[model samples]
Target: MVTPAGTLALLHTSPVHVPVFDGLRDRYHPGLVLRHLVDEELLRRARSSGSDAVAGPVAAALAAAVADGADAVLCTCSTIGGTAERQAGALGVPVLRVDRPMAAEAARYRRVVVVAALRSTLEPTVSLIAEESGPEPSFVSTVVVEGAWELFEAGDRDGYLDAVAASVDRAPLSEDSVVVLAQASMADAVERMSTRRPVLASPRLGLAAAAEAVAASAAVRAGRD
Candidate 1:
């Protein structure tokens, strides 16, 4: 089915993301339409050969969404976030990284703990944090939850969350540190984690940002008309 003209299309790399994003969209932007396009291979390719390997395909997906009448596109995979942002101008609509708002929030802290299931997400997420933090000096540390992705791949979501939580628990986190969940899939694990530090998750913040972008685009078009 063709999505409505004002639809917010989410480009995802995991099938499990549909319900999570849909729930967020329903709660935050119920009036707006929603669509999801999953490309599992994109993440796999990114993990194996780096984001450059999936940049072209990701750009194509964005272009297709725009052509299909998406008002805004949310790249829900951090692995391809840089590529999505690079192609945003050409897409003629907002193409936002899902971790953007979380990164921005993370930048406010003097120190940040970035937790991820995959190594591929570290660079883009840290770069986003730095970009948002801008000129201000901040300390950032990365913790990759070993074998967490394997659990996720095996459909053992509970195991995945437990592993992530365990990894965070073992890290030398303090009350002053801000913990950033580097991947959207890892967002739920934060709640399970016991930490005094503030935890940042992407889904709600990112979707809210995308909703505002869609509204802004519509306003601009209405003004032109």
Candidate 2:
């Protein structure tokens, strides 16, 4: 009657991510336990020093946290895939980089456009996703929304999502193609967009997959016991 699920630790760059994970946890299992590690300063430095500079430290921090007891580590930032993978490799634990699932999903479509709030966040993610795609989608591109981050920082959260939604609305989203939102913050607006094209957010995909992984791991462990 009792199911023993493992711990899932989410490492994020800001407090904004907490809500997303909480939503996932509530839906997946009432008993599912979750934890967080926020590196706001690293994010601040990344803003000026570039996304790559912050990746190493953030991933290393997450690795240490997982090694202590966490069953899995999920990196919420889409901009630091390389660093996260490196850290995941070193830890030898299940590290779910958020974008991989979305990227894999996007590969199912012919043309895919990734909408991102920051240029620094877009390039690396687009590259990594494109590389994972193998065949290279017809158009793997980014639509950058300038100043959305400032609105978020200024406590205009709705404005930020509205602005992002407006940008997504304006995009020439193809009916047959898929649209992926490159940031976790962008995940909130997918339902608001009335696009014929599919909109994928890495965090949602990652969290859903992580929940399943947690369930499967628990089942396997129970059998072994």
Candidate 3:
């Protein structure tokens, strides 16, 4: 479907997230229109250097998504999410980072174990958790699920998810620790995990926030009308 005005634009680094978010919209927010914008280069560039390397493009992408008639932009890339949200002053419309809600939830716990398939995602997700957790955040542990990203790159999706779930399950954590799936691709691993700790993923939480943003924007527009 065309991305009509007032639609929630999803900015993703990987094409894999399109169906994931679309499914979320279908099940939870059926009335919410979604537009998926995938730019693998943004993530590829960030992986090569760092999040700083892709800040300009990330900001540009958020602006472009809004320019294309998005009422709100939900950036699905945790690596560049901070950059996208920092543009709130200029973007005018709401820009939601998918991981923020997850991060906020992670803050409430005494310890947060962040899991991801890619090495590049560890720092960004961990740092965001701390930033949201206030002046003194919880002790954060990171587990980079080895070989999982390679499986994903090789199109072994099930293998990738299996590796992720297995790695998180195998990680040593206190029963009270909160587990956070740092990447959107790894969200589904929750169902596969045997870990007793609370696990949080961004897809559903992020999209729900975007749905609210869309509603608030519509409300404002109606008042203006």
Candidate 4:
């Protein structure tokens, strides 16, 4: 697949993500052209079955993006992120896990808190933190905010944000601990919190990394040509 320069395709599991990621692209990577492909069923399957069950869909999405002339692909759903990255190499384009950069940042802190609205995201997020943290171990705690996803699904954005924020506030976080919002949608909630601890959110960091990856891929291809 011959991808055009400065083109980024995001494979999202929900249509709700299009605006969120499009906004991030506009703010962080304004020069790059952004495209979105949504599969609403992917997340439901991932949550109910497993990430491996959605591997085929993830690979298909990546291939479709590359076929559509995307220089790189971003998997916006953390639930399917591992599968997307695993298949990235075969697609001939960068496929980035949205929480990777946030995981890297969280790994730097001695104590870390990972908060998620879905149970499926916890393991992948913790695994990413472990991978990024290297040989050294960090104290990582996880919190799954109850009712947050329901509120989000019901279109009660404020209710969802409040639930997440309240969960973060109730977490056993120290002043030195860094909090990580495990899902991109939780970013807004973290921003609204009054905690003194540093909070890491995936969207901005992930998109920045995606932009860099795309630019590097473009440069490499240009040199090769």
Error of 4 at 8 (Å): 0.7
Q: Work out the TM-score per prediction.
A: 0.94, 0.88, 0.93, 0.94
Better of 1 and 2 by TM-score: 1
Span of ten consecutive residues with least summed lDDT in model 1:
1-10
Candidate 2 Cα misplacement greater than 4 A, ranges: 1-4, 215-225
lDDT, model 2, position 88: 64
lDDT of 3 by residue, 78-178 (tens): 88888788887798889888999999999999999998888888888988888898776799999888888899999898899899899988989996699
Point out the worst 10-residue segment of candidate 2 by lDDT.
Answer: 1-10
Q: Model 4, residue 75: displacement in angstroms? A: 0.5
Listed per model in order, the count of residue pairs whose N, CA or C atoms clash below 3 Å is 0, 0, 0, 0
Per-residue lDDT of model 2, residues 1-225, tens digit only: 222467778878779899888876776555667788887777677768876787668767876877666767777877665567567666756777778788888877778888888777877677766776765455676798878888988988898898888888889866677888888888988878777677888876787766666666556656878
Instruction: Estimate every model's Cα lDDT from 0 to 1.
Output: 0.87, 0.76, 0.86, 0.87
- Residue 10 of model 2, lDDT score: 82
lDDT of 4 by residue, 49-97 (tens): 9999988878887898899888888888898999999987798889898
What's model 1's overall lDDT?
0.87
Clashes in predicted model 1: 0
